[model samples]
Target: MAGPTLRTYKAGSIIYFIEDKGSDVFVLQKGRIILISNSLDSASEIKEDVQKGEFFGVKSALGAYPREETAQVLADSVVLVFTPVMFEAFCTKNPRLVLQMLKVFSGQLRKVHRKVREVLGETGQQENSVELLRTAESFYKMNLKDHANYAFKTFLKNYSTSNFATRGQSMLDMISRGQPYPVEMDSLETIIEKIRLGEMDVSQNAESTNFGDMQMNDVGSMEPPPLDDFSQPEDMHIPDMDDTGLSNDDGSGMMDIPDMDLPDMDIPDMDLPDYTPSMKKPPQMNVPQPSASKPALEGITQFYYDGVNEFSKQNWDVAIKRFEAALSINKFENDAEASFLEKSLFELGRTYMRKGDLTNGIGKLSDFVKKYPRNPNLKKAMAYIAEGYEKKGDKQRAMALYNKVVSMPPRDKESNYAKTQLDRLMK
Candidate 1:
């Protein structure tokens, strides 16, 4: 299918600001975009670079809420802009995308609630205060079940006469009974239908709408199941490999991750290849070398190794943190030291991609290729980027990269994986 219209943005351009009304989602085509936000009173700062194959301005576009952060072009950039109508069609065709977006939005809601709680606590106000009741409702919508439970009960008990008491009562009842807080698949289907039929105008939602003013739609307010795992389609009835072609369909290998209360932190089989870094270092080439910091660089090396160990154990969450620490440590000093920085980026990107965080995943992997073009793993790295692009709905680039990998002379495990994915895509 054809994609949305592309727009160009020069470096230093501001796309939108927090609280600005917006109705279009932007897919980064090239270059960089940065999102910046602070607390309601600008007390704390949060910033993220928009990754290739990632969407920006989605929250505002989806809910008709004001933009929650400021988007600016970090470099000469291109973006494919999808209007609500076009975006809806794109999502219907790629159903997994809807689930993916829900995860993103849920995370966003959780962050907002966290900030709200912090502000209230600093003011010496009870969490259940009337002013904070709406924030509690937001907690529920985000599927932060535990937070919602505490917030709703506090609101109901301490502010019974408050305007939000009735709503809190209903939500609290659901939480008490352990009812599913997330909107069901059928409900989502119905919403899509309404939007397609023009019966639902998502933009009708006001720009000033916040947790307090949002009439709770069927938002889920519980800690959702992990994003990386998903059940297969019931009717398709395929072999165990299922959709992504990644999982082992063999009956005996299917092991559920059990809740273990031990210091050892045993991790279950996640169906990924065994983790092993190549002992063979590539011939050094001329690259822009950044000045390195002292003992801190040592810490970065440690964090990178820790990430590798965590990743092998399928402890993705911890692995991600370790990888991030490695990257953040000393702003990821250039390769004058060792391959730790590049290796960390590679693993971090791969981990995020596995966890359905396509943006950061693509960003890190793309950066790795740019920084280490002549590295021995360049071909493998490009293949990873291809998979990420494929996931992001950029078919042309994905197919081209897959074809490139297949054409390369030496065939490795990465190339074989790419070929498998390419065949799947063609089918």
Candidate 2:
């Protein structure tokens, strides 16, 4: 079945002059080939490099062309010869591959054009334009999400420098003042602008406040502007105070109006519900008002533990249900979010895992990993995850994870136990 072509070349030898037979084609099986072009001396220049398992010369094989380049061997080379017949037969058998190749070529052409434009545009004077080009190039090469993350981080740095400290101060000030007092968004904006423009700086006592504390507040207490009122504060005029704390010395403006400077006038007391900033509201037994419940997750969890013990030990199903009920109560509690109560998620996840319900166990464990990536029990949760996988009959995956455990240095006594268990499984 062999054809009449046998070609061999020593290292650093010219296999064939591409110009010698324009219609000849090559299929490389062993060795490296460099295609050189446009140099008076063939050995002096290499335009394209090819290696084993590569096929070239298709363009020259058809009578419509001359060899655009010379092919040489950079190392000892062997190639299978393909006359025009073999190539035509391949194209006939797989028309879908032809279409796929054409699509790939079209995509490459577009990519090249885009790169050319980007390189040209990168020469522009604007930094953002240059940044954008670089971002686009990076996105093209490494994918968009990583570049998006970089861009987001850049935005975050500028944002934190200008806003984080001031906003934190504003929120703490609101908390100190009690009640969700009306904050002029424009005023906050102006403060940030002044800071960015160097008219002001972050106060020397800028203490960091956890954002979790802020979100813990009941949204109902924060009475956002009435739904249909789209008015911006920029449309309203507030008097500018001078060194004397007076509006205008001319005495002809609202400054002349008596009682206008009263603090009560600025902050009115209305029948609108008393919206305090505390995470929890006190229990009301004799007094009757609609009070919000603000139990910490810890209390709810403890209550569940107590309830499980107090409930009939004879009715295991009821005890299990009681435990689940406790979890539900803990799930709704928000007061402890800002402090030590934050460990609730880990507790809840561990409880679910102990319940031996794979769905809830996996769900809680996954969420714990997301919310607390650096938690001490993360490895333990991962071990539970492997158990869950095993429970689901994914033995291959379980083995892969067991291998990881065997390789890892134990983090602590618990992890040492896990590693020991993994070794026994292997045995």
- TM-scores across all candidates? 0.31, 0.25
Candidate 1 residue-wise lDDT, 1-427, digit = tens: 5678999999999999888998999999899999999866779988999889998888789889999899989999999999998998999999898899889789978787877867775432433354466567568768798998988888778887553354456557667666543221112222333344553444542110111112223233212212211110001111121221123222221111111111211222212221122211111222212223325545665665556445544567877887777677654344433455666777787776666666666666667666655444555666766766665577777777777767664455456767887898899
lDDT of 1 at 26: 94
Per-residue lDDT of 189 in model 1:
25
Tens-place lDDT digits, model 2, residues 192-302: 333444433444212111111122123332332222111111111111111111222222221111110111111111110111111111111122111124254444434
**Regions of model 1 farther than 4 Å from truth:** 1-294, 330-336
Q: How close is candidate 1 to the true structure, as a TM-score?
A: 0.31
- Stretches off by above 4 angstroms in model 2 are 1-294, 304-354, 403-410
Clash pairs, candidate 1, are: 140-221, 143-220, 143-221, 143-222, 144-221, 144-222, 145-221, 145-222, 181-220, 240-249
Model 2: how far residue 100 lies from native, Å: 95
